[model samples]
Target chain A: MKYTVIVKPKKAILDPQGKAIKKVAENYFGKDIGDIRVGKYFEIESSEPKETIEELANKILSNDVTEDYEVIES
Target chain B: MKVAIIRFLGTNCDYDCKYACDVLGIKSEFVWHEETSLKGFDCVILPGGFSYGDYLRSGVLAKFSPIMNAVREFANKGGYVMGICNGFQILTESRLLPGVLLKNNNLRFIHKDVYLKTEGSRCYFLKDSNKNLLKMPIAHGEGNYFCTKEQLEYLKDNDMIVLRYASEDGSVDEDANPNGSVFNIAGICNEKGNVFGLMPHPERAVGHLGIDGEEIWKSLLE
Candidate 1:
C-alpha cells in the first residue's frame, strides 16, 4: 500500500517562510488574501503496514515539537 | 586529555576544531562518523557544517549516523560532549539535548559576530570565567532555538541555559536577539551538564580570528 504524509508547523508555532510568502501574495492579490502556511508533503511507495508507516511519519518525516503530520492511504 | 572530533559526511569544520585543540595544547584526533567506539577519548567535539546537505532538516539525517549511538552512550556516562552550530542541531535531533533549532525568524542566513553573556552552567566549559561577555562569530540559518513552555521552566530551574546573546555592555534583550531564540539563548547544556550545544562557533573565534573564546577552551580543559 502507498501512503502520503503531510507535515505542517504546529498552530502555535510561527512560520516565517509562510509569512514571507504571504506578504508577497498579498502584494499581488490584494490585502484581503487569506493566510498562507507552508508545509511538507511526502508520497511513499512502501508496502509497510499502516502502523509502521505511521511510526515513520511520526519519528522521521515530521518533528513532534514543531510540526503536525497526517498519513493517508491513497 | 585527548579530544575526539567527530567528522560527519558534510562536516567542514573538523580541521578548524582540530586546530583549536592543537593551539590549546590539547591532544585531538578526527574520528569518522561510522566509527562505533569512543574509547580513550576524554571529550568529543562535533564541529559545524551543512551535514547531509541540511536535507529534511539541519542535522536530522546526520543523527542516524552509526556513531551517534556511541556518542549518546559516551555522553550518558558523564563524558564531555560539545556541539557547535550544525553540531548543535544534530544534538537536538539525536535527542541528546532538549529543544529544536528552527530557521532564523527573519528567514535569512545570518553570519556575523555577536556578543555572548555567560549565564553560568554546571559544566566546566564555561564555569568560573572572569569575562561575563565574549564576542564570537555565528554562521548558521537554523540557529533560532525554541522549546515548549514547560521545557523552558525546567531549563531555568536546572541552570541549563549557559549562554545568551547580549550587547557589548552585557545587556540581554529582545533587540539583542539576532535569531529570535527564546530568552536570547545562544547555548545550553544538558540537565547533567556533561553535554552542551551552542549555535556560535567558539572554535572559529580562537587563534587568528579572535581570542575571546580562549577562556572557554581553557576552562573546559581545566
Candidate 2:
C-alpha cells in the first residue's frame, strides 16, 4: 500500500521559514492571506503491515517534540 | 584513559576532536559508526558535522546508526558519552537526552563566538568552578531547543541543564539568546549526568579561543 504523510511543525513552535514566505507573499497579496505555515509531505510505498507502517510514521517520520504527522490516502 | 571518537558518514570534526584529545594527552582514535562494541573505552564522543546530510532532521538518521545501540548501552552503564553540535542533535533525537533542536528562531545559520555560562552542573565534562564564563564558537542552523512543560520542570529539578548562552555580564537573558533555545540553554546533561549534548563545539574551541575548551577535555582523562 501507499501512504501520504504530512508532517508539520507543532503549533507552539516557531516556523521562521514559513513566516519568511508569508512576508514575501503579503507584499503582493496585500493582507488577504490568512496564514502560511510550512510542512513536509512524504509519499511512501510499503508492503509492510499497517501497524508497522504506523510505527514508522510515529518513530521515523515524525518527531513528537517539535512536529506532528498525519497518514493520509493509504 | 582511552577515548573513542565515533565517526559517522558525514562527520567532519572527528579530526578536531582527535586533535583536542591529543593535546589533552589522552589517547584517541576514530571509530567507525558500524562498530558494535565500545568495550575498553573510557569515553566516547560523537563529534560534530552534517551527519547523513541532516536529512529529515539534524541527527535524526544518525541516531539510528548501528553503533548508537552500543552508545546507548554504554551511557546507561554510567559511561561518559558526549555529543557536540550535530552530534548534540543526534543525542536528543536518539532520546539519550531530552528535548529537540529545531530551526533557529531567526532562521539564520549562526557561526561566531558566543558566551556560555555554567552553574553547579555535575556533568563529568566540566571541571572548573561554576563561576567561569567561557567564550566558545558555535555554528549551526537548527539549535533552538524545546520540550514539554513537565520536561522543563524535570530538567530544572534535576539540574540537567548545564550550559546557557550568556551576556558579557554573565546573565542569561532574552537578548543573549542567539537561537531561541528555551531558558537560553546551550547544553544539557542526562538525568544521570553521564550523557551530554550541546550546540557549541567545545572540541573546535580548544586552545585557540578565549578560555581553552580543555576544561571539558580534562574530564575525559579523570
Candidate 3:
C-alpha cells in the first residue's frame, strides 16, 4: 500500500518557517500573496493496514500537541 | 549542595556544568551514564549535548542509560534535578516531563539570547530573583515544546509553569516566542517543583560572557 501523510502545525501555534517564506514571497512577488502554510509531507510504502498506519501517524509521525495529520491514498 | 552532572557517551556540556557549579562554590562531580549509584549528591543535572548523536530522537537513547535509573529514583525521593536543551529532551522521553520537543518551526538551528519571564515566585531555582526578565542563550534545532491543553491547564494550576519567553522589551508577545513553544513557555518545573527542564543554557550565560549568567547561578544557591 502506498500512503501519504500531511502534517501541519496547529493554528494556535506559530510557524516560523512558514512566516519566513511568506515574507520572502511578499517581498519578491509584491503584496498580493495568498495564504501559504508550511508542513511536512511523507510518502511511505507499507503492507500494514490503513488503520495501523493511522495509528503510527498519531503516535509518532505527528505531534498531537501542535500538529495535525491527514492520510491520503497515493 | 553537592551536584552530579551525568556524562553520557556524547554529552559535551558536562564540564561546562561542572565549571558553573564550581563558580557557585558547590562541589560538582561527573557521573558516568553507566553508573548505578547517585549517592552523596543533593542534585543531579543532565547537561546539554547531542547524546547518542541525537539518533532516533534527542535524548531518546540516553533515557535507557543505567544512570537514569538512579536519577529517577533520586528524583522520586525529592532530590533536585535539572535538564538543559538535549537534557530536556531526555526528560520528556523518559516521561519525567509532559511533552516532547520537536524541530524548530523554522526548520533551522537557532542560536541567540532570549528573554524569559518568571512564571512563579516560589521555585527554589528562581526564588528571590529580582529580575523577572532573564536573558539566556538558546542553541538547538529541536526545541519546539508541545503539550495538550489539559496538560497546560494542569501545569498552570499547579504552578509548574516556570519561565516563559518574552520580547526584547520584556513584554509577553506571541510573535516574540522563539521556538513556537505553547504559552510562550521556555521552561517548566515538575509538579513537585524540584525538577526543571529548559531549552535556554544558563551555563552559557555565566560571567561577563555578555549576559548576567553569574547572578542567575547565585540565585539558585541562595
Candidate 4:
C-alpha cells in the first residue's frame, strides 16, 4: 500500500520558512504581503495495513508533540 | 562530575560537548550508539547533529538505539541527562522530556544568539541559583516545542519551565517570545529535575567564543 503523510506544525507555532518566503515576496513585490505558514508532505509505500500505518504515523512517522499528521491512501 | 557524551552515527557535537566538559574539569567519555551502559557517569549528554540523517524525524530514529535503553535506566536512577538541539529532539522522542520539537515555525534553519530567561531555581543542570536569565546561541531548523495544555499547566505549577526565549533587549514577556513556544519556553526539566533538554547550544556559549559562554559553563558547574 502507498501512504501519503501530511505533517504540519500545530497552529500557534510560527513557521520560520514561511515567514522567510513572505519576506522574500515582499522584497520582490513590495510590502503589503499577508499571512504565511509552511508544512511538509511525504509519500511512503508499506506492506502494513491501514490501521498499522496510522499507528506508525503517530508513534514514529509524525511527531505528535508539535505536529499533527493525516494519512491518505494512494 | 564525570560525564558521558553519547555518540550516535551522525552526531557532530560530541567533541564540542566533550571539550566544554573538559574545560569545566569534568572527565568525559563517548558512549557509542549500540552500547547498553552509561559506564558510571553522573551526567550524560546527547550532543547535537543530524543524527540518523534526521531521516524519519529528527532524533526519532536515534531514540531506539541500544544506548537509549541505558539512558532510560540512568534517568530512572536520578542521573542527570541533557540534550542540546538534536539532542533535545532525542530526549523528546525517548519520552525523557515533555513536548516534541517541530520544525521552526518559519520553516527554515535558524542560527543565532538569543536571550533566555531562567524560569526558576529547581533544575539540577542549571544549579539551584536564583538567576533570572541566560543568553545563549540556538541553531536548528526544528526547535519549536509543543506539549498539551495540561502539560504546560503542570510545568508551570511545578516550576519545570527552565529557560525561555527573551527579546533582544533581554526582557522575557509575551512580546519577547521568539519561536512562539508555549509560554515562551526555551527549555524544560523532567519531573525529577534530572533530565533537561534545551534548544540552545550551551556548549557553543561556554567560552570567550560568544556571549558570556564561560559564565554559563561556570554556572552549570556550580
Which candidate number has the best lDDT?
1
Please provide, for model 1 over A1-74, each residue's C-alpha lDDT reduced to its tens digit, 9 standing for 90 to 100: 88999999999899999999999998988784877889999999998888898999988888888999999998
- Candidate 3: global Cα-lDDT? 0.82
Ranking by DockQ: 2, 1, 4, 3
> What lDDT does each candidate get?
0.90, 0.87, 0.82, 0.81
| Poorest lDDT segment (10 consecutive residues) of candidate 4 chain B | B211-220
lDDT of 2 by residue, A1-74 (tens): 98888899889878888989999888988875867789898888988776776688799988998889888756
The docking category that best describes candidate 4 is acceptable
Best by TM-score: 1
Query: For residues B1-222, could you state the per-residue lDDT of candidate 1 as single tens digits?
Result: 889999998999999898888788888999999999999998989999999999998998989898899999999999999999999999999999899999999999999999999887776688647888999999999999999999999899999998999998899999899999999999999988889999998888788988877867775574
User: What are the per-residue Cα lDDT tens digits for candidate 2 across B1-222?
Assistant: 888999998999999899888877899978999999999998899999999999989999998899999999999999999999998999999999999998999999999888888866778788543446877889999999988889999899998988999998888899999998999999999878889899988887776543447767877765
Better of 2 and 4 by TM-score: 2
Off by over 4 Å in 3: A1-74, B219-222
Off by over 4 Å in 1: none
Error of 3 at B57 (Å): 1.3
lDDT tens digits, residue span B36-130, model 4: 98866888899999999999779999998999999999999999888998999999899998888876665668888888887763678777444
Q: Which stretches of candidate 4 lie over 4 Å from their true place?
A: A1-44, A71-74, B128-130, B167-170, B210-222
Q: Any residue pairs clashing in model 3, and if so which?
A: B205-B213
CAPRI class of candidate 3: acceptable
Pairs of colliding residues, candidate 1: none
DockQ of 2: 0.86
